[model samples]
Target: MDSDELREVLQEAGLSPYQSKAYVALLELGTASARELVEASDVPDPRIYDVVRSLEDRGYVETYEQDTMRARAHSPADVLDDLQNRASRFEQAADEIEDRWEQPELDRHAASIVKRFETVVDRARLFIQEAENQIQLSASIEQYEQLRGVLADALDRGVYIQLSIYTNPDDDVELPAEEQLAATTTEARHRPIPSPFVALIDRQKACFGPHEDALNEYGVLVDDRMHEYIFHWYYSSCLWEICDEIYSSRNDEPPIEYVDVREFIRDVEPMLLDDLSVGVRVVGKDVSTGEERELEGEVADVFYEGDDYRGTREIPLAQLAGRASVTVATDEGEFTVGGEGAMLEDVEAMRLTITSASE
Candidate 1:
């Protein structure tokens, strides 16, 4: 636009201040001797020669040894091509930044830190859709609504859904009724206070975000079982356990199913202690081989770290934090079954159903 701005553009394009001035002066002069360039550019006469040589090296100008050393600006064709290429690169880079912002790439076996909490919730849809046997979720009422349809689809597929929806206690939010929630989730809870949005799917993948009102907005996407384990506990103790169940479509009678070992232990531990026979069928992965397997048997024994604890509503998540397993007596033999991603057991259970109960 202006002479000063044009000079600035040239300087920003890798020309030194003096080179920019000298080149601009040469272009206006059409063809100039060293003395003429010094007069037009206002560059110190002593530095003009070296500046012209630098411009010549960059193909911005050409110099010839004449009666008094003549110099002239180059055709500018190559310079225009370079600028166009740079513009294209900048445009491509901008698009890539937007794409990555919208869908942050997550590592399959590690955590990926993402910029926005919304990104975590949005990406979690696919994980929720792929849920095989279990899903643990905590959401704001809005977030819950956003995921309600997918959760309903998963429920129709017989995936165990545990959801906790929260809002500020002061806000008189019209919460969903039990009848409405039962269609989407197996169990749902409500928190009168704010909580982070968390989704743990099939004990293998997790999406975690800070409270929506947090000053810094960030989230974590985890595909690691160990990372998922930590997120699972967080969801359990803070979000799910204390909250009162608002809606449940759980089958309260025989043939009750549990996707979590801790829950399985809680319900069936009482039956086992009562000397009632609880028959179970477990679908899970083999601990040693990581292959999917289904095992059916009668409950043999229940084991955990603490002797005083028999899994019940009163038992805290911390109590269930240590080793907990179900030993089943099949026709083949008695084998131990643990929770999802269970490392120290015979099988990592995805779902365990009490197929029969006998007095």
Candidate 2:
């Protein structure tokens, strides 16, 4: 290599610029006095002695007295060997430091803000994988596509999922057939408004906030169940059902089924205890004809069955000219309600629907 390239290599291997130049000059000159080095290597006259001494100390050069001291560059192999030893020490120290480092657990309830999009996606993946029973998620179509693989894995693990896709309200967004087909097992829908991004797990934890952008893009993670429930309800009552359900001629069935009145009552007891009303739509199956029907209502009463809470809800029936009350048992699972043998238990799937804010 040329002198300039060799100097750069030596400096990269840990030598100072003056040391590199002096060493390279000595290699070419065979042996050189300090004055010769300054002329040949362009090292400043005042710093040449210190540079040569440093090179000698690093084992890159040897000095001998010849009236005045003269320096000789060590064999190229020897100088490189010394540098290699230094590189090895650096690697060892790095490994030791890494081993001693302890990363603290991230506080989910804390308001952590990540500005990078990649970090936001990575955190979202952790939230999905950490979910036990359910995952409630809302994102723009682009964001959803980015996380589809992680979400598919969550579903494979039997975690029930509710996904909502957000898009422009004024434009017709064509749904990708394969993407829609892949989510048949989960409750997936679309909304026209630009909804906030959200991911809630079992109503126990959540990460939610605005989309990624050049501005202050961030998310708030809540581990406190009570705080997460606010997000849960918002996801269920707003983002999840804010727009018309996406339908396709090729799609086989609806992504969601109504909860039986019995299951609905049991699932919503927490809200009742908090003196909050939860609106649920119950889809009943006709046993004889295999026909399906629905009833929308609110919880009206609560009772205890051993350790679990059971409750009742009243649904107004136009045929009966009055409201019909249905008893819901957590342990019993399903039952029948009203006059026309409209079966309430074990019909299909159950889901929460959007309700009026006042209700």
Best by TM-score: 1
Candidate 1 lDDT, 3-54, residue by residue in tens: 5665776666688899978877776665678999999999999999999889
In angstroms, how far off is 173's CA in candidate 2? 3.9
Worst 10 residues of 1 by lDDT: 93-102
Residue 24 in candidate 1, Cα distance off native in Å: 35
Clashing pairs in 1: none
lDDT of 2 at 5: 67
**Model 1 alpha-carbon drift over 4 Å, by segment:** 1-105, 310-314
Task: State the lDDT of candidate 2 residue by residue for 1-359, as single tens digits.
Answer: 45676667667777889887887677667566788889999999999999988887776665655467766554344454444566554344333222222122344453444333344455577778776567778887787877887787887886667678777777577764655535532666778777788887755567776754326664565666667756765776678645566542222322223322333334345456567654445544444565665545554453332431123333211212222234322233433343222333333323333242122
